[model samples]
Target: MNRMNWYVVYTKPKWEKKVAEKLNEIGIECYCPIITQIKQWSDRKKKVEIPLFNSYVFVKLPDMDRNSVFQVSGVVRYLFWLGKAAIVRNEEITAIKENLSNTNISDVCILPYKKGDKIKLETGVFSSQDAVVQEVTNTHYILVLESLGCLLKIKYKKDTL
Candidate 1:
């Protein structure tokens, strides 16, 4: 029997929940972390649940069954890293769950920074890498990885780092 590994699936914008639901209905184990936020409109404010990671969802299955996920709607493809399917360790998933469940941590805010500021990556492939801020955009941070000597642009959502 093949062991299951957690792999990230890229989804169409705003489709993370639907895709995860479909996968679950099909007997596939999937996780899409959600957070509740209050959205303010011109008139009123309302609470909404949103995925933690935009366009991304995690699914666990054997490598050979990776293709099965494609049958679900809104699943674009599996995220790849270094020419192979990006595998997320079980511990990382557990950490995310634990962190999210912790009520003491109300919010995680990234301080406003300007160019040339030294910062350490908090997550993703370059987690813990020291990088210099190259440019700041409304949606992303163009960073120069000091140790790797490469440039990377990471997109950020308002509530996430």
Candidate 2:
């Protein structure tokens, strides 16, 4: 029997949920993490569920079934790492589930920076200041202001790093 593994599929813009649904309908297991948020407009506020990872969906399948997944509409390709299809470990998926389950959607956005990434403070009193990422948490990033010899932690909603 072919062993199953989790792999990330890159989808068309705004198609993460569609791809997952179609894959599931075809009997392929898939996971697309979504969070519910209140979206406000000038006229009204509405609750919307959005994919946590935009343009990406996870599919659990054996290597032999890769072509079947690719045949699905809206699936662009597999996410490749080092010339091979990137395989997501089971533990990583479990950790993601646990983290999201415990986190409030309004309190956190995705953390894209890793330790040692140089980023500029895009907004706030320290706007435009350059800092190094010292650590990352579920809801905040701990940054080190090298010149000032101080550490700062901030929560952000935009990809303004």
Candidate 3:
């Protein structure tokens, strides 16, 4: 028998929670990470819970049973990486759960840096190194290291710059 692994499911826009609930009703293990944020209107502000990863939910199932997710409403497809279904390790899921449940964690806002902006690396081996922003995608920042004449691509989370 195949062991279960976590895979990301792409859902219809604004349907993460609905998809998760439907999947669970069918006995599939699913996780939808949520975050509470205060939204302000012209007159009043209200707290809302939103999915941390937009249009995405994590499902735990064996590789052979991956197609079962399509039975749930709003499920579009599985997230693909390098032409195959992307598998998220158990450790990553645990980390996300722990981080979301931690009360001390604060909302992190990513700085809006444009192409050609100069920035310094803060956490990696190239700490203190200067690099120019080549491209900024939704999930990654492509940087050109001037001194080393190389390119570095960094995948970032909501909490990191």
Candidate 4:
């Protein structure tokens, strides 16, 4: 018998929660990591919960039950890596849950950068300054500004720095 394993599923846009719920209702174990954030409008602010990884949910099931998961509404397909369903290790799922529940992860979005990439500061007091990426982290980037002869490390949202 095939043992149960965690697999990643892709859902329709904005359907991560829906797909996970439907899968659970049918007895399939599923996880959809959600993050709470404070959303502000012109007048008032409210707390909102959104999927941490947009359009993705994790399902735990035997390999033989893959078809049943696909039949759920809002589930587009399994996330494929190298032509097969992408398997997520149990440790990864646990880490994701722990990270979301235990961390104060504010409105931080990770931006991809390489060690030698030239990045321009687009916000803050350093706006318009050009720097070379020294190191990249999940929450911030270490940049070296050639003109200023100093290194700057800061947490930034995507496209803002």
Per lDDT, the best of the predicted structures is 1
Worst 10-residue lDDT window, candidate 4: 145-154
CA error at residue 16 for candidate 4, angstroms: 1.3
Rank list by lDDT:
1, 3, 2, 4
The predicted structure with the larger lDDT, 3 or 4, is: 3
Per residue, candidate 2 scores C-alpha lDDT tens digits across 1-161 of 89999888889999999899999999999999787778999999999999877788889999988888977899999887667888877755664565457533234344343447787767734455566877766556565533222344445444433
Which lDDT tens digits does candidate 4 get at residues 72-96? 9898888876677888777556645
- Return the TM-score for each candidate structure: 0.68, 0.69, 0.68, 0.68
What's the residue-level lDDT of 44 in candidate 4? 100
Better of 1 and 2 by lDDT: 1
TM-score of 4: 0.68
**Pairs that clash in candidate 3:** none
For residues 97-160, could you state the per-residue lDDT of candidate 3 as single tens digits? Answer: 7656756444422233344778876754345556687776766656553322334444555555
Tell how far residue 59 is off in model 4, in angstroms.
0.3
User: Which model is ahead, 2 or 4, in terms of TM-score?
Assistant: 2
Query: Ten-residue segment with the worst summed lDDT in candidate 3?
Result: 105-114
lDDT: worst 10-residue window of model 2: 145-154
Candidate 4 segments whose C-alpha is farther than 4 A from its true place: 107-161
lDDT of 1 by residue, 1-161 (tens): 89999999999999999999999999999999787668899999998888877788999999999999999999999887677888877765765576556554444323333347788768854476566877766666566533222344445555654
Query: RMSD of model 2, in Å?
Result: 10.1
